[model samples]
Each structure stands twice: as C-alpha cells, then as structure tokens.
Target: MIHIVFNEADIPVLQQAISLDESLQGEVVVIRDDYAVGPLDHTYAGEGREARLNWWREVLAGGDYEGKTDTGEVDDFKTVAELVGTLRRNPEETIWIWAAQNKHDVSGYYWLLHFMKEFQGRVFILYLNNLPFLSEKGQLFYPIWLHSIPPKEFLKAKKLARPITLSEFEVDPDEWIRLCQEKKLVRILEGGKKLSQHDADFYDIDLAKFITVDWQKASKIINQFQHKNKHTTGDAFLLWRLKKLISDGGFDTQGEIRNMKDFEIKLKSQHQAETA
Candidate 1:
C-alpha cells in the first residue's frame, strides 16, 4: 500500500501512526507543493508533461520560494510525476490518500485521482477534514487533519477508512478538473461548501499595524484572527504575502526579507496617514 499526504508536517504524525500497525507499512509520499494558492494549469496528465513542466517553471521562475529556484521546482515536479508513474505501474498495490477538505489537500487529492484514472487497484481516501474525533476528555470534535488527532486516535481512524467506490470517483474526476481551472481562492468548509477569499486583505493590513515589531509578535497577533483550521494560512505563507505587501507600498520593513526574525514590519506612512 502507498500513502500520500499533502505536506511534510503531516508525514511524521502519519508515520508514527503507521508504525503502530505493521500491516500499514508502505512508502509515504509527500506532494511537497501547495496547490491552494497558484495557477494549476496542466497540472494533470491530460494536459501533457511539457505543459505541466512549463507551468511549474513559470510559477517558481522568480522570487525566493522558500529559497528554491525554478530549476529546483521543475526537478521537484519531475520527481513527483515519476513517483506517481511508479505507483501507476503497480496494479496490485492499494493506494491510500490522506486528505482534508481544505484547498491544499483537496486539490492534491483531486490531482492524484486524475492521474490514477487508469490504475486497476483499489483507491481509498481517508478524508479526515470532517471526521469525528474523540479527545482525551472524551468530547467529540472534527479534526482538520490526521495530525490533529492523537496518535492512538489516528490509528483508529485508519482502521475505519473504507475504499472509495468506482462509481463515486467516476462522477467527481471532471469536477476536480474544473476546479483546477478556477482563478479565485477558497476554503472548503464542512459538507464540502467553499468560502471565497476574493476580497480578503485583512492579514496584510492587520499584521502591518504591528510597526517595528518582529514577525514572532506579529504572527501571534495574526493567529488570534485564525478561528478555523480550514481558513488558517500558515505563518510562512502569511509572511510571503506580507513581503508582497511591502513591495507594493502597503507596508515597510527593515532587515532581511526572507528571514522573519531579521526584519521588523510596519505599515506604510501613506496608508497609516490615510487611516489616521
């Protein structure tokens, strides 16, 4: 069996859960890319390899993406394609996808399903985004990811997951393709409804209010606004967005742009004066 997850942070919790059961051991694949925030043109096999590589190259072409170049990400895309191709070749292996309802995991899940259209083996999705979980206090709550659950609870959820039916997946593959073409950003709520982020700029404005403050303090203030896990963008992603704001004269900053601690952020005087 092969288990696929959306990010590296998810891998350790999953690996620890898988370790508790020897039968669940298999290669854990992390997609290593965020599909939630960018153009996903030619992201699947139907669009062809050249187009896919071109899209990835253009996105990673400039600006420090966690300090990786366009060449590096192009290679990374090839690595992912090759890994999926290997999984496609094995008809006997069952593929398990660990996904959530958020755009990050949902987009990856749909893309993987699009690629595995020809695979003969069973495909199961442990969609944990809304799965009911029991806490140490024995209270029921829906966890946004398997990592949110305790290790022992994760193991139990793994056991409870069932194989997705052919009929079900058949109807949704086209929907996934349509989603890839969408230009607007969204967050998936419970029951698969999407909340649009078309006009949201609160993060940039709110964080910029913390003038002459390190990112640590800024992030702490910003975190208070993150009420839901599905809608929460990571501190790194927020910082990247903040950098763009700084570049656009929405804010001003001092020190290394890439290193959060090395810089202090402040609202631009023009914007500040307008607000005042």
Candidate 2:
C-alpha cells in the first residue's frame, strides 16, 4: 500500500503511526504544493505547469523561498505520475489518501482525484472531517490538520478509510476541473468536500488586524495572526501577502523585508508625542 498526504509536517507523525501499527505500513508520499493558493491553469502539464512555476517565482521573489522554486521540491505532477507507475506495475498495490478538515488538505485531495480515476477501487479516502479525538490531556477536540492529531490517534483514523466510490471518481474530477477553470487565487473549505473561491487578498484583512501602530517584528505579527485565526495559509504565503500589503502602502515597514525576523511592521499612522 502507498500513503498519500498533502502536508509535509504530517509526514513524521504518520510514519510514527505506521510504526505502531504494521498493518498501516506504507511509503508516505507528500504532494508539496499548496493547492489552496495560486493559479491552476494547465497545472498538470506543458505550458500550464510553467505558468504556475512562474507565478511561484513571482511570489517567492525577494523572500526566503526565493530561488528555491525550481528545486524540484514542489512537483505534484511528477509525484502523481510516479504513483500511477507504481500502481500499474503492482496490481495489488493500494493507495490511501488521508485528508483533514481544512482547505489545504481538501484542495489537495481535489487536485488528486482526477488522476486516481483509473485506480477506482484501489484508491481509498480517510477524511477526518469534524471527527473528535483526545488530546494528550484527555480532552476531546477536532483537528484541522493531520499533524495536529497525536500519532496514536491515527490508529483510530485508519478505520475511517473507504474506497473512492465510482460516483465520486466521476463527479469529483469534474468539480476539480471546474475549480481549475475558475482559477481563483484562493480556495476555502465551505463544508464537506465543498470549496469556495476568493481573490488573492482574501486574508489581507485578517492579517492586517494583527498589526498596530507600534512597531513589531514581522514574525510576531505573523505568529499572532496564525494563533488568532483558525484558517491560515502557510507563513511563506502570508509573508508574500504581507509584502503586497506593504507595497500597497497600507502599512509601514523598517529594516529589510527578505526574512520575517529581519523586518518590523506597523500600522500607517503618526506616533503621538510624549509630554515632558
């Protein structure tokens, strides 16, 4: 069996889970790209892939991830092709796709569905949507990301697996195609397998809310925003947007903007003078 996950952070925990239960043992492959953001035009091959890579180059320019775009790290198409090759060679091999209740995971799942149609019964899904699990403190809570769940909790999650039905194989691919056609910069999870599209600046308002007139490190503002908001894109994406906000003159900045810790950001307002 082969295990597929969207997030890199979830990899270690999943490996631990496989260690605990040998029955769950399989190679965990990650689709590194965050499908929730960026252009999806012809993403699978040819000009579309180049366009998407160009967009990523633009987004990562002048940031920490700059020049890291072509490192062959974020190739979902190659990953899927390799998986298909493996499946074709090993007829008995099965695939388990694990997804949590979040836009990132769900969007990744959507992007993968189209390619898994040929593998029908061999493809299984374990969606942890609205499912409650015990934390280390023994309190019950729902997890938004698979990495958020303890490794032991995955034993219970594995039981939720079921084959991707024929209807879903047919319909879900259409849904993904439709989403790609829309080509929205952002995708948000509305509910069970449903996603809503938004503009690139969708999270700008929330990100700005964490900023104040007082100068604070960019890292602090980003950390605070992530802690306060339930739904968040990754830090790299947020930082890209933050730079956009800065360029738009909605906020003021100090120091270099390449790395989060290298810069300070504040609201665009005058400071009050202290009385002697």
Candidate 3:
C-alpha cells in the first residue's frame, strides 16, 4: 500500500500512527505544493507548466506562500511524477490518499486522479474533513487536519476508510476542474457549496485599518484581531497581505518586515487621502 498526504508537516504524526498499527505501514509521500493560493492549470504538458510558472512568479513573489516557488525547470514536478511512476508499476497495489476539504489536500487529490487513469489499482481515500472520531473521553471530533487527531483516534478513522469507486472518480475530476477555475484564496464550505476565498476573514483593508488606529506594532495588531475576530488567519498569511498592502502604498512600514513581529505599520497618506 502507498500513502499520500498533502502536508509534509503531518508526516511525523502519520509515521507515529503507522508505528502503532503495523497494518498501516507504507511509504508516506508528501507532494510539497500549496495549490490553495496559486494559479493552476491541470494539464501536465509544456504549455501547462509554463502557465503554472508564470502564475507562481506573480503570486508567490511575496515569499510567504509557504516559501515555495515554481521554477521553470520542473523541480516541483518530480515528486508527483515519481508517485505516478510507482502507481503505474504496481497495478494491483492499493493506494491510500489522506486528504481533507482544504484546497491544498483537495487539489493534490485531483492531481493524483489525473494520473490514475491507466493504473488498475484499487484506490482508497481517507477523507478526513468530515470523518467523526471518538476521543479518549468519548467526545466526538471532526478534525480538519490529520495531525489534530491523536494516534488512537486515527486508528478509529482507519477502520472507516473506503475505496473510491470509478463512478465517483469520473465525476470528481470534473468538480476539481470547476474548483480550479474558481481561483479562490481559500476553499471553505458554505450553504452546501464548496466556495473559494470569499469567506476569508482577513483582508487588506482590515489590516490597514487596524495598523492605522494607533500606529500599533504588527504583533499587537495580530493579537488584537485574533481575540476580537471570530475567524482568525495565521500571522504569516496576515503579514503576507500586509506586505502586499505596503507594496501597493496602502500602508507604510517603519522597519524591515522580515517577520510578522518585525514591523510597525502606519497608514499611508495616499490611502488616507483617497479615503477622505
């Protein structure tokens, strides 16, 4: 069996779980790419590669999209290619995909399906987004990431895994394409629809407003909003957007914004003038 998961950060926890259960033993593959905030073209050809590179060059130039950039040299394609090769060679092998509803995991799942057309293998998907697991205190938890589940909780999830039927795969790939076309910053569940970044709680405007109020330090602003807002974004993502705001003259920086805590923000005169 082969195990594929989206984030490499989750590998240690997964490995620890596998150690507990010998039946879960398999090589864990992490395709290190963030499909959530970048342009995606589904084709694995020359034109598609160029399109991806061009898109990454624009979006990830800010250097905070998980610190990954798509070089035109096919460096990022190697991991997925190797996985596809392994699947092609082992026709009867069972491939297990550990995924969630997040764009990163879902996109990776779709990319794998694109290459599975020729493999006569049985594919099992452990979709963790909605899987309910029993806690030690017998509380039920639905986790967004596999790392959130305890080792024992993962064992409970393992029993509920199911194979991806041919009919499901055939239709899912189309849905994946539709999702890609949406080009959202985040994929969130809403009103029975998987929508894109529309529900993203953090925005450039809000950052500008917060930073301008007392010219507070970035750390204070982050902490303030984290407590005030119901939906909070990570400091890195907020800092990334803050940098973009600076670049676009919405905010002025007092120092090198090397880290989220490194800079203090002041509202730009130009932005204030426009708003006034």
TM-score to true structure, per model: 0.74, 0.95, 0.77
Residue pairs of candidate 1 with colliding backbone atoms: none
Lowest lDDT 10-residue stretch of candidate 3: 191-200
In terms of lDDT, model 1 sits at 0.61
For residues 29-99, write the lDDT of model 3, one tens digit per residue: 78665555444545467776677666655544544443455433335477767867776787767778888
| Deviation (Å) of 68 in candidate 3 | 4.3
Stronger candidate by TM-score (1 vs 2): 2
Clash pairs, candidate 2, are none
- For model 1, residues 1-276, the per-residue Cα lDDT tens digits are 888888777898888878888878888888766655554545554554455545444433333344353435434356557766776687678778888656677766766676666663477878875668787678898876656666667777786567876765786677665665664433343356243333225355555544443334334434553553225565555656566666776555666655445566664566575884
**Which of the predicted structures, 1 or 3, would earn the higher lDDT when compared with the native?**
3
> What TM-score number comes out for model 2?
0.95
Worst 10 residues of 2 by lDDT: 267-276
Task: State the lDDT of candidate 2 residue by residue for 133-243, as single tens digits.
Answer: 998788999998899899999999999999999999989988888888897889999999999999999999999899898999988999998989867888888999999
